[model samples]
Target: MKKLIYSIAVITAVIQFYSCQKLDIAPISKFTEANYWTDIDKAKLMLNMGYNQMYSAGIMWRDEFLSDNMVHTYGTSDQNSIRRGEATASLNLFANEWKDAYGGIKTCLVFLANVDRVPGMPEATKNRMIDEIRFIRAYLYFRLVNYYGDVPFFTTEISLDDAYKIKRTPKNEILAFIHSELDDIMNRGNLPRAENLVAEEKGRITIGAACAFQARAYLYEGNYQKVKEYAGYLINDPSKYGAYQLFQYPAKKEESYFMLFTPENEYNNEVILDITYVPNLKYWTNMSQMAPISKNAEISADNPTQELVDCYLTMNGLPVKGTGKDPAYNENDPYVNRDPRLSATVVYDNYKWQNKNGSVDVIRTAAGTNTSDSYKGPVERQTKTGYYVHKYYDWTMTPNNQSGLNIIMFRFADVLLMYAEACNELGKITQQEWDTTIRPIRERAGFKVAAALDYPAAKSQGEIRDVIRNERRVELALEGLRWYDVKRWKIGQEVLNGTMHGFRFSGAGGDTDGGYVRVNQYKFNDNRDYLWSVPLTQMDLNQNLKPNNPGY
Candidate 1:
């Protein structure tokens, strides 16, 4: 796909700070003018700008917490932002989210409505472009309805004076609106795979991509039947739509899935849906923005918490408490033969982490510079959480340079786990179902079939649910999914809002030292810190918007 780079100043000005003062009257022929959508290229540019909104406020930062990638005890200084984010209150960011999404929604609607009016445009091609825009609009509204319980419904771009009168619709009504839009796209039957895009057309919307989101939208809304139906539609008939398939890793017993996120791999087959990144070319990916700064240019910022570490199950397919009887559970012998994912997801002490150039063990000893690979520059240190995130990042790729790894939107493993979770929830899992679906993942990861649960399990589901939950945590950790899983499942307080801890080498002393190094006990916090407050500036803008979660 040909990459288009817009001036950051102009894009931001148009979206967040679009006041009359900055809206200079350009010549009538300028692209920004109201009637400039007279050509095919101009229409395409407008649609591309709508896609860019997904990169800005939509998923990038929000996913950091929503996906359980990281948490902050004291990152922001705005207390009001924090207040509205209290799990029990309304989040201020939540309100801004509505605006951000609607901005893109209006832009898409306008472009789609006006694209056909462009002279010389073929009717067939124009119809395809309209279908793509509708898909994008449906996707934007899907994000809004999921985050905020209810939202204003807008199909066409509204004038400034008419915008304020928009009323909020109930979530169910909004969801129905979304479903209607998706059904229309399906009926239109013109969606294509990302790979089918000619050399000039990479990163445009595809049929498989639309279906994946359709599946995800239903999954998030607790509509399991729809989730299964849509996911099955994509997975069961691979020959018809060959864009997606489960990973097949022959070298390792556990199959590790990989996809394109860089320029070289941008059009690879495995990626179902991903936002593009261009390092020196366009704005680099969110990974570039978020990864820790390193001197060698091979690492980035971001430290995984001990809480996330504990979420992984033992290698034997049991919880830590359940593994107490096993030798690896001894207090004196932490980090022994543990779950394989633990090593894959985190760069813990003494693990041989290999990057493109070579391999290095991450040992953060306070003695000299407690970090791995001195080439990563001074600021690029290993994680403070006593572990490094390896998922979604190719460690071998020089971290300092712009990275190409595509941020994966969805994958087959997530679907399988979701299926097991839904079946477990609805009392639908049979022994045959477990063997056909869940067992393969467990066995591949070196785990035995999990033991059965008691009747209490039936009421709230069983160890099966916990197993699938942990699998997602370990498998999808740092991909930016963990935090949201906590909120939707109502486990955020018990998971994130707790004491954070990490290990120091055996010789260090004090709290900075991993207290009692040989013994891996954790430091602690309270459950009241559930949700994050929306930023304070947003709260000051909208009064009706409330705080998030509960106890701030």
Candidate 2:
């Protein structure tokens, strides 16, 4: 029995009704407090509500716009505004993200407070469920602190008066709390290892998830030692955390990387934590807005930028520009002799786009091309950039583009990359580390050349860091992680400033900078853009939320 909690179950109605009310108001439901916690299934239902709020596919997809990886051209979006350095404390993105994260935290608290009253639940099962809720709470807090430096922190639900008066906790304190909470949950030994989970419990929280999340937290904190120690748990002892390896297909090596996102590969060992969705039931329609215009998509909201395309190294592991360039890289035919992931991720001019009826069509995005996907100078429902995203095309999507593919939040490849980065930062990276982490990732990406797999000789620490960072970018592009990486690396000004470019169409008209399409000029205030402001609406409700982020 596939027992993953589909988010659209009847319990969702109850959550929606309660979620709309203010946080100060008590969660009202048809079932009174006395009867709601009487059954184990009801407890699970409440937990499912927390799962639904953990992550959103739409938010994840839009996050790329905040980074240099993508550009929004259709119209103004909150992410676009923020990227352009026009974000105010009143931006809906800030308010909505704050509200949604707290709502999720509240769901976890409610579940933890009432689950003990559930009758006939096995001690082991109840304890495991409690840890799961705790993990969700920690994850929510992690997001909150990452976005807003300091926020009002809480564990148990509070009264209306207490909620209003609660002051902002220091970001460091919140980070420490998250670390301690995750450590306690993992040390308790109630959660199962990733490999031990049965089909019915596929999407439940595991020890590996907690460990990976902790490592990511340390990564954001720039504590390389802690990142190494926590990420080492999975890298060194798979028997303890879980045996996670990059998903590969030896017969079809080139297609292995992209195939990992297909529906047939859901619940693969590579995925550490993912949002669960059921076909024809709980699904997302964001793909309809992202798919190619020629492929019957409703609208093209954003497009991959040339900056992201340039990050992919050649098959021989050489840069396309700067020092140690690829000698065979052709300027006119930039797609050839490049990393296989680039083709898998983006659809450029003359790209092959497969259709629902098993037919393939070539997408032409150059100016004056006879195709709906052609470049038309930043018009509505068209790609401003001369490219379309091909990484997440759900073959099993409905005619209306409703897709049920689970969105992976954490995966094994990311774990390896994190370990590699931490090792490099600590100056402890060796050939063995390279073989285990970067080498395998490149190999699975269909890179057969020894230069791409073997550890480079006579390279300084800085050079190795660049290689690792570039590898992480191409491997994890369009996964909503680029923005966090940019923020953590403090390269917002270096990357976000100046004009973003699209495909190079020689002799194209209108806003062409030496044949490159000028998508848009962006600005990044290094001091203020690094942290988002506390929403003005939030501050109005609670005067304690004073002293907003700088330059707001």
Please name the candidate that would achieve the greatest lDDT relative to the true structure: 2
Per-residue lDDT of 416 in model 2: 92
Tens-digit lDDT track for model 1 on 1-552? 435444433444443432332111110111234456567766667677677765442265456544334533223312223322333234445445555676677667657556767889887778778887887888787776655555556676555434434445677887787777776776677766655677666666777777777777777778878877777767666554445645545554353432222234454555666665455545443344233333242333445555666666656544554433454564444566667667666555555554445455454323245454221221334344445555555443444545544456666566666666666666756665566456655555556544412122342456557666776777677665665576567765464443445444443333443352221222112334333433344334444334432333
> Residue-pair clashes per candidate, as listed?
46, 0
The local distance difference test score of each candidate is: 0.54, 0.83
Model 2, 19-112: lDDT tens digits are 4356432222223366668888778888877778888687689777788999887778898888888999999888888888887888887787
**Over 4 Å off, model 1:** 2-35, 56-58, 66-69, 73-99, 239-243, 249-255, 258-270, 285-301, 322-326, 330-333, 358-362, 365-382, 394-401, 442-461, 504-552
Q: Return the lDDT, model 1, position 134.
A: 84
